[model samples]
Target: MTVLGEPRTADERRTPDRRGAVDGGAWRARARRWWPAAWGAVLGAVLFAVAHRAMPDDALISLSFARNLAEHGQWALTTGIEVHTATSPLNIWLLAALHLLTGGHAFLAAGALLAITLAATALWLRDLGGDRVALLGTALLASSPLLGSAVGLETYLAVAVLVGLVRYAADGRWLPAGVLLGAAVLTRPDLLAAALVALLVLLPGAPRLWRALPVGLAVALPWHLFAWWRFGSAWPHTVPIKGNGRGWFDGSFYLWNSWPDFFLVSFTGVTVVALATAAGGLAGAAWSLWTRRWVPVALAAGAVVHFAALGLSHAPPMMYYAGPPIGALAVALVLAADTVRWGWIVPAGLVAAGVAVSVLHGPGWADGLAPVRQNWATNPEYEAIARDLPTDGVVYSSTEIGALAFYCQDRGCTVVDGVLADPGRVDQRWVAPWRAERPWTALNYRHYRPPAPIPARWRLEMGPAEPRPGDWPITRAPGVHQVARLVPEG
Candidate 1:
């Protein structure tokens, strides 16, 4: 070794330099390889950030069920009653399990779910077409205004399931693919169509893929069968209770209305994704027809079939439902690109546009305290109402009962609603499905049981909230909630 002041030989100098160069090269290589996954991490972080911050009134409905299940070991939303209003069984179960795990913090459980599903989605996309596919797909999803607003719903879980379905189908892993398909249906029964279309178009060459059929039935049928036996109807009570949506199944509507979420609630992102879907779908279909490249075709068809299913069912054009297909189309566009290097440019540009708009808009993503714009009232307002409600007897709410019921659960107060908190009533009716008759609903008399006639002690009244965004005349200003002590009717 030379003294500190002495200059080292050229060999010694080159040795450290060479090692530095080699390490630098390796690190650079790793960065290059994982750059795409970096975007996925960004997506997950963004999702987790917003998920628990605020959610729509509908989301709290699910959480209420989870809370009831977790805390009381019962399926009823309130004591002395059982309701079947929560739409997704899997969402309820997942949320309930997480709810207990998190020591009864409801929103934290939702945030946890959002992160978990984002990771699952990223992994599945990476499996399908390396990290770039994950990057492109998650970016498309993250940029959407709809999915961000639907953080606490089954949308995130459903998306992760669908992405996994696509991956398994691409791999010819039909058994697992079928299981995912079943889970997809349980996430929202409407997703079954998308699941079938993805598998059929993606792998028509595999005859053994038929094995998926029986396995999927085994997984999904049990839940439906149990709901029928236990709840008196296989269909969600929500089927009839919620809005059936607009008559928008036409070609013209499909072209413009399928995906309408704007970036940062601006008009910029409104039709951007819709147009991309049309152009990308046509291109993907054409490519599949000409070159037998069915991957693009499968993606396009899955998106199309999902929207079609939603349209035919007159399902509300909820962004949560629209988001998964938007993601599928975005991925298809990238994969169907004429040149791998540039195919991502256009879709990536749209993503950039979304992020840019949000950045320009400012202050929105910085806080997670605002619920979705579609909410009936702010979280604090709901909490205040729950806090002020009477500690006992029945309380009725005509507006925004989900959060009210959830917050009021531990108050020794029984919240009942014609809309939710209680499973109101199913009239005497019968309908035939094809050639078979099915049990329409379970008639529960919880509200009328012995010591039964629980008179409404208070009525939580509120204005119609501007008659819903695009509906007819606006009768009253928004945010009108109050409690009135009710008198028993003779």
Candidate 2:
């Protein structure tokens, strides 16, 4: 053949053109299909932020502690104190790493944690119900406000354990799963009860139980030993020492108050959706058992048992405690859905509504108190105080110690009863005297003068107040020094 005569025919090139056009169209269609999921993730983050408007003081304390740890290798849980009573510093260690990676922006660290949770939830759903079903579950989780609040390194540690549970449950990998669960327990002991129930599910055959239980026990031993040494007993036991949430196993208070509160936290979505999903999940298990759907039956049952066992405890329920149930509800909703063409719209709509409501109504602890609102550590008052005061020496303040300690970058300043630093040590006797309606004087202290011995240098800072005749009125009294108002120098 001559040089130009050996060229290919038009048919071959023309056929490829048609095929390429078809491929392009297919890609466009796929992108259209996934657009909803893309939008859902974006809106989910927005909803999450709106729901968690007020940062929890406890979270802030943890953030501060983590910052101090990563920055300076500080080992103490309480600022400027050598008290090592609190057990297991793993959560703090993780958060400190997160802070260091994020260059110390707590918000960015929180967002990163959220993204990881979303990814983990997606992976779990994919394993359970294939790609489409998993996407639905991911959308629901990403949009949930309660889970959003839990999106931090502190919460990520718990989520990692959950991922491990799902992973091992799918494949029956005993040792690694046990180690992960043990780590979760160390991070938060409330998870221990749930992890135990999950372990029972994964290793149910009594013949193999003897072998597997030891494996898990081996993993959990070191944390327990460290905890026992630190807290004088095993486990941090936050429920007992940290709060006054103790109650009898009777019918009155536990039934009415505790149970109702627990259920309320669980039922964040539409009442109908919540109740129907729960019912369907139970019914599915029953049907699965009859039809030999042993896997789903086991999973559903394990989830329910874990939820009920932990939920029916004396510690009192919080939103974070409802994580497993929330996850169960997500699974149930997906199971109930018809994942056909345009079927995801049902769950997507419900998730959107729930997220909207949560953002609008979630509670803020710092909303009502005037002093707390105005004189926060982030405010100019604390900054001015920090600038003027001696840096090496500590300033004693009541009711805002945590904020002062964090914002002033001075570990020496002390505030009374900040939930983070003080925990159970902030006694009511001290708090009542510190925040008495009027200044403490001879009349008020005739019976009791506290803190039985006040520090000589630390004086009471007071504002203008109306005096009552009988109460301890210390207006213009000796040792009542005015904290001079100082503005920023610049």
Candidate 3:
């Protein structure tokens, strides 16, 4: 009814640049601002599917906690007794919220969380670095087999929070940065060192930064306080279970994880990978400092600080713990690019080696899914054992309890002979805090373990030398595994 060239009245149509009506430019602008995140989401969703297939047995531990928390209003994996085995409060809570909101399983919740966080991470990285660098960083994260293996865990969430913290801190937005800093700690307390290092490096002369500390503490304090009040400790039960053991998070361990297994395993391989890594890091740090590329430098500093802290403390370096630092290092390396002169050689060599190894590493990195390594076991196999377990009796599993408890539909029913479920340590004192007060008789500690008497009705171990009847094949692993039934000790 209107002429094509005529101007429209206020009641009619608005111009493209105006705020009133549907505008193509606005949508284009939004799409431009968000395309990187879409790329990241696609990458994340694909990887999550892969990880879900081979989801580690340990990862299901937290998934179960989340499921039980959502369904039962209790923090315990098993019923009755409340335990603090979940190391990441934020991870479980996020999973719980996702589970409740969508009425889906915990793994589904985890996959959704992974995609969202990675998308957020990509957008932040875009803001911190330019589009090309951001995409590279995202690729590095999405391609890592280690992160793929760490699905259903806090690593994805913490990395996203860490990236946001770095982004805000670099942009001089102290308040939001502080909030993310606290979230990082809550997600993975070990990230504290990384946060401090990033802040110190990024804020050499920034003013009014003191407010960030108080805000961060405010955000993170209440949970620790509540935990201490209820669980008799401020940290997760895992701190005692695996903390202070040596060689877990050290340089050799990091190197081993960074490269493909065939590329580096022996002492010579470890040494070469370590040296190459150190050289690449130093070059990146130098270039970042010289060019005032604050994010890359901050990222590198975080990796160094975390590795040093864990290594110096002789902390047990579990494989799952490598994600954040390794991820940070990867981002830094990709962002650093070529330095002036001969310095480019180091980063180039590093990049070349990593890419070559990854290309040869197979579909794990290619499809952006979890790697099926030689020895470790994963989801379905563990779930099979868990379903096979009798919930009526105390099924004592010494090796893999996480997937078992989750599948057994936890109720404090399946107790392992491990310190992870030390029943009621309300008044307990550590004899040797480093080793989790293990070796009770000689260590002079009485932190009570859920006792499993010998010759019980069910004994689940790592299994016999070879497969026999009643043996369950851990599809992810090449070994004998079968639950044995014995005469009741009573």
Candidate 4:
């Protein structure tokens, strides 16, 4: 009559002991509840590792800063120069720590750090939404070529911190939320707008609001003070350089072209999933507004801030810019799924199909591995140039400054960034060159050569030089003097 310390009735005995059946059913339900998120976390880590293998040139710039910090005790893009050019101070610090731990393997360290961050984010998403929405969101992000391409950047880490801040704020943990928001700002200064939105969400209670404000300021103030003291500004020189001369129409054009181009050109199934998730996010925002749910409202507001800031800025709408928007879409989809339980299935299936296609017919793991090989094999030219230069020579490169500086770090040649190091010193004529060439744009200014004559022992130019057997062509435009030789006297 007793089964596992519980009394069993005669009816149960007649029913052949339903307790085991009940326990089995409960176990199955628990598995259903937890399995998708666990699987999603694993998948996210794998995808992030693959995507991060091909480190972007910008990431290399950050790595150079990290390397300098680790090896030479300098917080600059180029060692021995004390400059506040790092956009993400926390990211640089973290990468520097990783570099130290990994014996200076910046790329591998970045990949590992990114994978862990992304996996943890996926798990946290599951706690916010159920397993289905978590899986769906994680799959969509993992399948995105752009998101993957941005692995070495701070995009994912910033988003992970944003999600954490929202969760803490929703739980009324004001101080922790504010601290995380501040950390997000350190990761990406543009998220300051999102931090403001979060503050608004916590404003209903005066005590909580007051507590969060000081905590956030406390975390963010040190870096600002240091930057202001060191650089005379709390912002990097890149901001002014990039912000100058931006057309009114450039932002609008960038916004219009970004999402559409990605969807049209990227894998079809993933695009469908993205579109559906975005629709879900819009609907969820409306629903949250109607219901007066503060968490979803704050998240939607943060997404709006991110999109508006990037869209209105002088920066081009690259794929990584979509990271915050995609995060908002995932949260909105999760909220929407809570109301209509089965509605997540369609998008989930699209994401699953996208993953399947990527594995079966796409590059799959090769995408991540190719970058390591390419970076190893392709930078030989830079090394050769560095080898050819004298010990006291200076090399000025326009576009590949990060790669070139990295290669020439210990070659006794001083590397100066032609564009970003000091834009104020750049001659406007070199940036806006005249003669028979293509129309100029804002990006051209970032790669402009200096018009000043070289007064150094030696100066080597490594851009589009005179067409030679192995010379890299900087541009294909005919009659464009893409030669990298001695600077002629003006």
Best model per lDDT:
3
**What clash pairs does model 4 have?**
none
Clashes of each: 0, 1, 6, 0
335-388: candidate 4 lDDT, tens digit per residue:
555556576675566466556555553453343322112122123344455555
lDDT of 3: 0.63
Give the lowest summed-lDDT range of ten residues in model 3: 1-10
TM-score of each: 0.76, 0.62, 0.78, 0.73
lDDT of each: 0.62, 0.46, 0.63, 0.59
Local accuracy of candidate 3 as per-residue lDDT tens digits, 131-201? 66557667667766556667777877877887888777765678998998889889887788998888887
lDDT of 4 at 152: 65
Task: Assess candidate 2 and give its TM-score to the true structure.
Answer: 0.62
lDDT string, candidate 2, 1-490, tens digits: 0011012345632543465557786666455344444544454466335433344334545555666677776644445442232333566666677778999875555555455545555555554454566566666655554554444325544543554564454355556666666675666665555555545644542224334356656766776675445433353434333233444435333322543444454343433344444555566556545644333454466557656655465434344445555555455455435333564666777567655645454343223111112122222334344445444333445434433455655535543232224433432332333335336323423333222222223422334444433222221212332333212222
| Per-prediction CA RMSD (Å) | 10.7, 14.2, 8.7, 10.1
Which stretches in model 2 have alpha-carbon errors above 4 Å? 1-53, 75-77, 82-90, 153-160, 204-215, 237-239, 242-244, 247-313, 332-346, 359-412, 416-420, 423-490
As for TM-score, the candidate ahead, 1 or 2, is 1
Sorted on lDDT, best first, the list reads: 3, 1, 4, 2
List residue ranges in candidate 4 displaced over 4 A.
1-41, 205-207, 245-277, 353-392, 410-414, 422-466, 473-490
Clashing pairs in 2: 401-415
